[model samples]
Target: MSEILLYDIPRKDPENGPWSPNTLKARLALNLKGLPFKTVWVEYPDIPSECKKIGAPPTSTEADGTPRYTLPVIYDPSTKKAIADSYAIAEYLDATYPTDRQIIPAGTEGLHAAFNKAFMDSVYFPCMFTIGPLSVSALNPPSERYFRTIRGDLLALVDSVRPEERWRKVQAAFEVVNGWYEKADNGKVLLMGDTPAWADIVVAALLVCARNLLGRESPEWKAVSEWHGGRWAKLVAALEGKVLYPGYGWTKQGGQS
Candidate 1:
């Protein structure tokens, strides 16, 4: 078994955003695939140093030399391979491990590929567009003072978008996700079938982020919202803390706390 090291920020507060989803997805995938790995929780503004030490790129670096970032950059110590990006990391695990307990389906690569792309467009992007701005705006003046100096670019990126438009886009995306989930599940418990698949993991991560961060009440996404709050809860709870590969723990605990 290969040793895996996941680089992510510790979930100190509940509203941390991207890092939570990134870590959650990686942990779930590892559990679903039955891989074992160690988690290395780094703080915001120091992640770049941690990344460099582990042979990974710094996603963000401050002028004062800090590296707060996202992505559970997976380092396979045995092979000296480091991978970043959530979907890429998941795909790598699925292909390399290839188990009967596969996270993404074996024969349905096309479907998974489409789902992955759609997720980025529909769920991930829009949700970030909405929450990122709100989160920054809501930060206390002193806290904002610290973050603004280091992450001013990110703050500016979200501030450029109109809040109304961001909300509308997020709503539209959730509706699309809900529709897709309804069609895929066909009133079943899981997204694809009785068993949870890679598609489930992808959507589950999206719903978790949306509901937790973007406000759970959406008239347009009622069904999807309900399903996510209900059915998906059971799935994640059942798989909590199960390791899927070396050094990676597939546990929901990383995000919830």
Candidate 2:
């Protein structure tokens, strides 16, 4: 099979590669499927142009109603098709590849959809203040400049909060998420019990993002590792062998496009 090109926003750390949660979702999906691919690092400013060059559709609209192009676009050279959006990418891979251990799996779409929304609300947004600033520091110079320009208000908002308050909210957010996990059968590490699925990929991406942005030794990350009775720590550990870092399953290619 011809290599599927994965468009990812590169960070300064080449060894760790991409750090954004959403892009990691797509990358993790491809890794889980054992697909052959190469990472084409697209800087923040280049995402719109690169996506347009490949005809990857805009995933959303900006506040002013202009189309917004995002990263984590996969261009399958074999099929000559470009797909955008992480969850959509998962669905596409499951449909096109049809592995026995499918990402979406049959009859779980609605459940997964509900969990996605709940996870975003309960955990993702609330934890942003804690993790958001760290993301800026992780970016390459060009992407950092572009990110500051567009996300100034958000970064400022993150800075305005007291560190104590920010951490309190983060812990609270995870507490809510912990409740959801508790509803699963006893000792279930993943959302789908022993089986990993798209939901597991999503949560794992968040944990990986946290670990990277916060630094593994940082107190924030340490606290998270111990949260919910060490639930997240175990989840990350379980996925350590599955989630491929750079130079493992895929090669990083040069050039913006």
Candidate 3:
């Protein structure tokens, strides 16, 4: 089969490659399935245009009623299909490459969906205040400008919180998620026992982004790495060393083929 094309956003740190949690989900899924793919980096400001050019549908609408396109889009040369959204891309990959280990295993769709919703609400949302500001610094100049412009209100909200309170909330959010992981049978590293799946992809993606955003040696990263007896850190290490595809890399410029 021909290589799959993954659309992702670029960060200023070329050494770290892609950094968005959403896009990383797609990257992790592709690697876990052992698929051959290459990244087509999309700049923050050029996402809509690049997506439109590739026939990827808009994932949402901006607050101003303008259609909003997002990355984590995949264009499959074999199938001549362009899929938008990370979850949808996962589903497509599973269906097309059934021989590979399934991301959303049979009889677990509802469970996975529910887990994703709760994760977004309980963990991702709360931790945004702590991690979101760090993302701004990681972007290239145009992307940084675009991020600051579109996320002014969110940035304001982030700034409104005191550092101590932000840390407390971030800790509380992860603690709730850590409790969920603890419920997994046999103290497994993955959400699903003895196997890597969609849930693990969702989590490891975030952990990696956090490490990049916080800087691996920063105090915030150190605190997160030690959380829940180092469960989160171990999870990322496992994914990086064992599961995810090692071939992932990015072009210097975004929105280029």
- Each prediction's TM-score versus the true structure: 0.70, 0.92, 0.93
Q: Candidate 1 has what TM-score?
A: 0.70
| Per-model CA lDDT versus the true structure | 0.63, 0.83, 0.83
| Runs off by more than 4 Å, candidate 3 | 250-257
* lDDT, candidate 2, at 222: 90
Question: Could you tell me which residue pairs clash in candidate 3?
Answer: none
In the order shown, the candidates' Cα RMSDs to the true structure are: 5.6, 2.6, 2.5
Q: How accurate is candidate 1 locally (lDDT)?
A: 0.63
Over the stretch 145-231, how does candidate 2's per-residue lDDT look in tens digits? 999999798888888889899889988888887877787788688777876788888888888888888778888789888888899
Ranking by lDDT: 3, 2, 1
Looking at model 3, which ten-residue stretch has the lowest summed lDDT?
248-257
* Cand. 3 TM to true fold: 0.93
Clashes (N, CA, C under 3 Å) per candidate: 17, 0, 0
Poorly placed runs, candidate 2 (over 4 Å): 16-18, 245-257
The residue-by-residue lDDT of candidate 3 on 1-257, one tens digit each, is 99999887777776664568999899888887888888876778998888888799999998899998988899999999999999999889889998535899988988988989998998887777788888888888999999899889999998999978988987888888889899989898888887689998998988888887877889888988889999999898878875653655443233224
Instruction: State how far residue 154 of model 2 sits from its true place (Å).
Output: 1.7
